[model samples]
Target: MHRLLVVLCISVALVAGAEQDVLELTDDNFNSVLKQHETTLVMFYAPWCGHCKRLKPEYAKAAELVKGDDPPIALAKVDCTEAGKETCGKFSVSGYPTLKIFRGDSVSQDYSGPREANGIVKYMRAQVGPASRNIKSIDEINKFLDTKDTTIFGFFEDPDVALAKLFVKFADKNREKYRFGHSNDPDVLAKYGETEKIVLFRAPHLANKFEETNVQFEGSSESELSTFVKENFHGLVGHRTQDTIRDFKNPLIVAYYSVDYVKNPKGTNYWRNRVLKVAKEFTNKATFAISAKDDFQHELNEYGYDFVGDKPVILARDEKNLKYALKEEFSVENLRDFVEKLLDGELEPYVKSEPIPENNNAPVKVAVAKNFDEVVINNNKDTLVEFYAPWCGHCKKLAPVFDEVAEKLENEEVDLVKMDATANDVPPEFNVRGFPTLFWLPKNQKDKPVAYNEGREVDDFIKYIAKHATNELNGFDRSGKSKKTEL
Candidate 1:
């Protein structure tokens, strides 16, 4: 029956992709087929995944655009559940849909670019380009630097210089993340310098008088070039948007305000200038960026910053995943103070915890972020934690069944705890990605929690506890029952 279902899923996927310009790959031909193309963007996905279904048409459109790509960049898919189960397992694809770039036998990299058709086409095209674009005229130089992308331009007295060759190799390797151009023409070299040198033109959108418009790469090696680019890429005060947030390294101190470069460039720089002053004070301690308030207003609302006036809200998140926030007027002095306190661990973390319950002695106990350590982690009992979001429909449906299970196990030395995940800061130990996530933490083995992936019915929970619980229940059976022991 399971084999039949797998074949059916593959058939369905193939029929859906028949009209689209996508390759249906299987374990049988996975290795051989990928080697046919120099670059193939293979998506290891399950046919039943909702996200993969939505991304199908967009990926198909991208495949059509790249059909004519030189060195042959093919967009393909592998149904992980059936045809490509072994192939997906080899690549360690744990998710429903995972996109990876395969370049022959080379180490595959995650396809981190945009998912839409046009964006995917542009991104892949960059992968097949010359190491660096040729800059013949000064006009070409200006035009290349005008883009929102960070561009690297190298100028050498002779194009065949050792430095120029090194630059080409570096550009070839990092073309996916940055744009590169070069000119050996004396006219172009005269504009910048007569000797071989590289200038990293930080994106135009991030232009400010606070820092140099173009930074010099003083190093010779590729590793040094990479370090210099990553360090100065965002400028002194980085303008972070939704697209660029993940790029910023942690130990980040970001100020959220009106950061509009198109409309109010001067006013945008005004707030940024203040942040830059403090940013300069702590150079290597933390990375500073300014995000648009309107862009991330919804995120701020979740942090209890709604209706808080337009004063720039300062928030910091360290490498430890702990979050901190300060909604106050910024000054060169106070902003520095906040960052110093954060570094010193003097500030209390800003957690989205609901107020601790005065009475949590019920069968099903409520665990808030504020009281989670006391009620769940530090307690001397085996616990079943349900991290749920209030808006989740699945959590709503599971409520009655979960409560009934709690009632049945009330006499046992176990905690059946539920928390509103939305209004709480879960510890990093519990990676709660979705709604209605359940975990079983044994009293003796609190460090390692087992996820409850069994059926939602009471019996399933009882069976799981019986097998894993630290102690036997009194008079009640291990398999969630009252009266006499069952096994």
Candidate 2:
């Protein structure tokens, strides 16, 4: 009976492995195949990967199933054991069954875990980035700690009942953001226990300031250990910075914290330290404070604020705008990291509510419109003036775009103004027949606006401005070809 069962299992495995054709990818046709297909599933696997070996037939079955539903997703495998070392490194593949999904040219999602064919099929169907694996090495763990994103790192002696309970307690609430891991090696545990010795073992050349986090924990209960770990290490997670936090002179106030907030004095103290560390980095860049004593609302009201959430709030503003950046556990590293991201033009601010200014249409005191005054235009300086009504859908869409354009052109001497055609204050003679016609007055007189084209062409509009706007301030980077900022 045992022999018969073994034969059946092997036969089933063989049939499953043969279910789909696996394309072998080399450097040659990788880009072409990826570009040509709507959806491509590329697996980076190694011969030594026990997980990969098990996942092979499962992947083949998944490919067959997915193909049935969606013209089939192309399945290809790269053997790290063979000649695909560079390919694995390019994708940042640290583990096997590293499934990357590409939709045309861009990678949409990635997966790494114990996945059967059905599991892979289900994951592919959802088309989301796979759940990230836990950080293994102490270096990787430190990186997670320093990340701006909320992170949880679990240190378990064994994958036993107690550890399982801890995971069950927090995993649902924290999910992929948290790290759950363990080490049975006594040498590994002893090093990470009480000093910089573990850090030296993990990262030999780490700087002193960076290496200071290596320490000991004197606790037995899960709560005690949790408190100790978070208090000492939680603040390393990423945070919002002064640059992206606000442009307003009115202090960029932020509340730093761990995403996990335990109702204890120690936990609170830990949270406070993290917030201060973040605040200190942007000392003069903006004002700083913590949400201790639940005084967030009081402080916000006193200073005029706009922010999101209670855990880690960052309210920033200059003279004119007060905006909120993100809602997560905060830290100093994150605040500075977020600032660096903003410098890279990667930080994105979302609009939750629009501010109702006292004078929604304040007088255009900056410039007065005169009749036939050569319809003042400039491209070297991108000037954008829009005629619109608040009720119109098209106007609403264009309004956000206009706001983005203005933000992007903040220091570029770009004249961004809006005229309400519906308002009685403006002259009736400024007869704009259409509801929202944009006037792009570029610096170059040759590219003058002869007529109005009512359509949303963000790229064209930016180009028109760049060409004509006289950038006397040297705001735009002129080193490379003119790259229009996508507002």
TM-score of the candidate numbered 1?
0.72
Worst 10 residues of 2 by lDDT: 198-207
State the number of backbone clashes in model 2.
30
C-alpha TM-score for every candidate: 0.72, 0.26
Let me know the TM-score candidate 2 reaches against the reference structure.
Answer: 0.26
lDDT (Cα, tens digit) per residue for candidate 2, span 1-487 = 9999999999888766665466677656677767877777888888788888777877777666666453346777888767777777877888776888788746777754336664455445434232323445666554545522233334555656564345445544333223333343445455456321111111112112322434444544557655654443323222222212221234344553333233453554455555556644654455543443242454444333344344555544332233445444455566667654543446553333222233433222122232113223422444566777768788888776666655655656665666554431222224467767666555455245433363465554555555555563344443313456677
Segments of candidate 2 deviating more than 4 angstroms:
1-151, 168-180, 194-315, 318-393, 396-487
Candidate 1, position 320, lDDT: 88
Per-residue lDDT over 198-291 for candidate 1, one digit per residue giving the tens place of the 0 to 100 score: 9988887777666788889899898898898889888877888765677688899988887877789778888888898888788888999998
Looking at model 1, the pairs that clash are none
